[model samples]
Target: MSYGLFKKVHYTIPVEKINAVKLTQSLQARITGRYMAEVINVGMGDDGTDQKAFLVLYSSRNSMQNYLQMLLPEFSDILAAPAEKQPRVVWAAWLIPFSGYLVAIAAGLLTVLEFRPDFLKQTVIAAAGMTLLFLLSAVCRFFTAGVSVKEDYLILVRGYMRRSVICVSYDKIQHINTKQNFIAQKTGIQKGNLHLLASALNMTQSVPYFREEELDVIKSRMLKTSHAQ
Candidate 1:
């Protein structure tokens, strides 16, 4: 595959938009070839003129062809744009364990009111302990898992003590999984799962937090690399 295969895709968002600056920075550093940026629309208000710009990105035909090859495990096609995305674990996960804590509190109250049981205190303490454990687990899951793609290797980092990294050359990726549980689903947060051609020591570490559109961008880029190689 050659760079000529790619076709340009243009996207523009106002500077005031959340993550806009980050997106621009990533494009400048990570993307290859000719691009353009200019203020398209500016806000006129008492506050000030907000800088608004249009960004043009060129992706060769080869880039698009390569991207098609980097499919995820269960998905046949790459993701289309999803609106109003968010980072994984932004809030849904933090609140999941609290639901259990709420249940425990309700149970404790019921036990104390209906029966003057000494065990009620023990049960409440036990519930608290379990909730603490759940919270810790969520923290670990949030911090330890992520994906990083370099020129040739796509890296996944997972776990604390059971730490490991899996390096898959861009061409070998068989599939990618972007998933969310009921908690994450409701809140519009997602975690990514990358499945490759061959088994590695740790396959699970590739999961990463991503906003929906961000995930699509990554998948597209990885696929482009895979095919280009």
Candidate 2:
């Protein structure tokens, strides 16, 4: 096929009053054979509402033309305004893992000071090595983790040593849950879990520390999308 014959069409859908499941099904039915829809979670509203946005990428010109023809009548209500792309991880994510590392290093140094002052230099070196390892691992994970939303599907990318990208369709999602500890809550960071119907496995994704409002937006969107299909 000629490059000119294929054009990419992008749509950012806003999740609000519309039935997300129905909308996704309708779109999926139409584009199944003609084009692939790449969906991405563009992030949530700063206005502090449960507003969620999605970016859909269509690679086929015919499918794009067909979708555009029906978009206004079928999806305009769910169409969302453009949103700023959220960063992959926030600064607090960089700090949380190091908190434990800090505690461990402090305890080690104190033990050496009380019992073996002559080994202080060795303790410091060991502590520094441990700190460097923890920092490296945390930074790698922070950079590697990612989540993407698509029509009828959600994609989770995670890990550093054994990286994996999992694609789960909305239909296969049995439940969506969120968790936060007292410190996590205070820091505005939370973890989300997706329960899958097929293997009875839970896929977990962590949101780096962010505004509580933004977290709510992301959680709401996931729940809505999972339930919709």
Candidate 3:
């Protein structure tokens, strides 16, 4: 299961100003060996105007890497940015939910001990086991989740039991939204959502507990790439 999760890598290329046909041909030529490629039309914009953007999906990470290597020189200015990982504070956000669970478990334990002395040992063991499991899961998730920005694509990496990568092209992005509650605002951590036009159903990629300033930079880069001729 872990092997399957790590096998795939998702990435994208921007073809807004470039010729899609030519770009596809170039990618195909460079991506040798066994691989599958599909071109998907992302549909019209919110204003009812035809959006010319296309999403190119590759079956494997090697194929995407080969394509990027071949295409990078031509679009260097647009794709020059390096990928960014989730900040340490992002992982700390898990403490909020963990704390809630801990509180509930403590209350339950207290109630049970007060009512029944026979169940005290069992209650204590169960609470300790649950707390350990939650902490482990939170730590694993915190280490695994991250975001990377390429020339034309924003890559979202998420995993716990199994990992998956979602690469959204700039032109295919319909909206970039950010939100922060009172606690999050105080900590300078925010949640971000990327709304995409390519999926038939409303699809969103979420980034939790990212630094607000970093998200703003990503949002700015995405906007600039989307508007590029």
Top candidate, metric TM-score: 3
TM-score of each: 0.47, 0.50, 0.61
lDDT for predicted candidate 2 compared with the true structure: 0.47
TM-score for candidate 2, residues paired by index:
0.50
Model 2 alpha-carbon drift over 4 Å, by segment: 1-89, 181-189, 200-229
Backbone N/Cα/C clashes per model = 18, 3, 2
Each model's RMSD to truth, in Å? 18.0, 13.6, 9.7
**Per-model CA lDDT versus the true structure:** 0.46, 0.47, 0.56
- For this target, which candidate reaches the highest lDDT against the unseen true structure? 3
Task: Residues 1-229, candidate 3: write the lDDT tens digits.
Answer: 0112555434354554332111222234334422222333344233454432333343354555565556434332222334355677664555677778989998999899889979999989988998888878777667656776655566665655444445556666677888876667777887778776553422466765567777766767767876784
Q: What is the Cα-based lDDT of residue 61 in candidate 3?
A: 46
Question: What tens-digit string does per-residue lDDT give for candidate 1 at 1-229?
Answer: 1112475434444332211100121233223532222221223221343323333223442443243234121111111212122255566755755777788778776877578766777777876787678767667556555555444445554453233333445455557777776877776667766654321322233465555555666667777876776
Ranking by TM-score: 3, 2, 1
lDDT by residue for model 2 (1-229), tens: 1122375433344433222211222234333533333222323233455433322343354554455346424332222312122244444554655677698789889999999999999989988887788777767666655555544445555554434344544554556666666665666655666554321122233333334565445556666765665
Better of 2 and 3 by TM-score: 3
